[model samples]
Target: MIADEIREQIDAIGIERGRPLLISDADEVLFAFMAGLESYLQGEGLSFDFSSFAITGNVKDADGMALDREAVRSHLGVFFERHTEALDPVEHAAETLAELSKEAQIIVLSNIPLAQRGARARALARHGMDYPLIANEGAKGPAVRLLHDRAAAPAVFIDDIPHNHASVRDHAEDVHRLHFVADTRLARLIPQAEHCHARADTWLEARPIIERHLFGG
Candidate 1:
């Protein structure tokens, strides 16, 4: 769902015609979210199993027992507070986006607490991806739809989550969906989402696909 602050950010932007739009996720798509989160979890005597795409069921303690959602949620809160500003960008993510942004309206639409929005934005900017970062909560369809409505040209949505790909399909079916997972471990665990037009595990592979779709050869 789109938050009020996110709506304000959208209302402030203008998408020029013929310019393609790239709406992307921050964690695991542009930034190394799982990598950072795993290290942070380790600091707290917890570790991620990477058994599945979802987080709540995969984080385990030193004893190898998965923690409940509530506990994991609390740990996540701390993790973001400690590491949001320090997450390493996925290799080639920034340079690719920087190149694309010259010809497209690129937006980082991430599902994160509003408190971490500024930090994430700054982190991306430091790596040369200084686009508008919108903070979202659940099913990113509505927010993607609003952003899509503002564009009169080709649009592409990228994320590591399958449900998000499906959500975008439900709301903005015309937008090209690209499923991207930066971490090889998580990438291996996730199957190709049916709604995604294509999948890329690295930005090197992603750039050409995005380029071909956003601007016809």
Candidate 2:
């Protein structure tokens, strides 16, 4: 179960008034996570075993033995502590989010450790793309539900995780779900989704779909 403190913090950051066109997700969706994580691990004498899809126990050192789940989690905590501020946004992400904010109430819904939210938001703001960022924990369905309640209708959820996308599909039947995989390597691994309204690898490619669905362009 997610802690009340974190949920309250997330709720405080969500879009509260009027119908919203919420566009969110932080790692991989907005800022690169896999690449940054890999680099951080390498600096710590650890590394990803392949370019394949997996994290935690799947990652390993050069010898090919898995890093074990606890070590992986510890590494991630340290990495976020040191490097969350260094995350670089995907190309055109700032402009796209800013533009979308003008047309609709843009709120960022992200499932990251609560400790990293402040640094993440500050980093995003430093890049000129700050918006209301939620530091959600666990499955995103409940968080999406909260957004749905606030926005009423015309909510659009964008994320890179298949599970998170599925969560939204289950909770918000009317919301438009966009599966956005910005990393070239991970994009290929994202399975085809019948529930997804659109699958995009770049903001440039997705702008048309977002404009059409959100604004009837």
User: Could you give candidate 2's per-residue lDDT for residues 1-217 as a string of tens digits?
Assistant: 4467656865676455665576578887789888898789888777686555568666787788888889888888898899999988888998888887777887777777788889988988988777878887776777777677767657788888778778778877777888888788877765645677888879998887787777878
Candidate 1 residues lying further than 4 Å off, grouped into runs, are: 1-3
In order, what lDDT does every prediction score?
A: 0.88, 0.78
Give per-model TM-scores.
0.95, 0.91
TM-score of 2: 0.91
lDDT of 1 by residue, 9-107 (tens): 777666565678999999998899989998898888888997887899899988899999999999989989879999998999888888888788898
Steric clash pairs (candidate 1)? none
Write down the worst ten-residue block by lDDT for model 2: 11-20
Model 1's C-alpha root-mean-square deviation from the true structure amounts to: 1.3
Q: Backbone collision count in every prediction? A: 0, 0
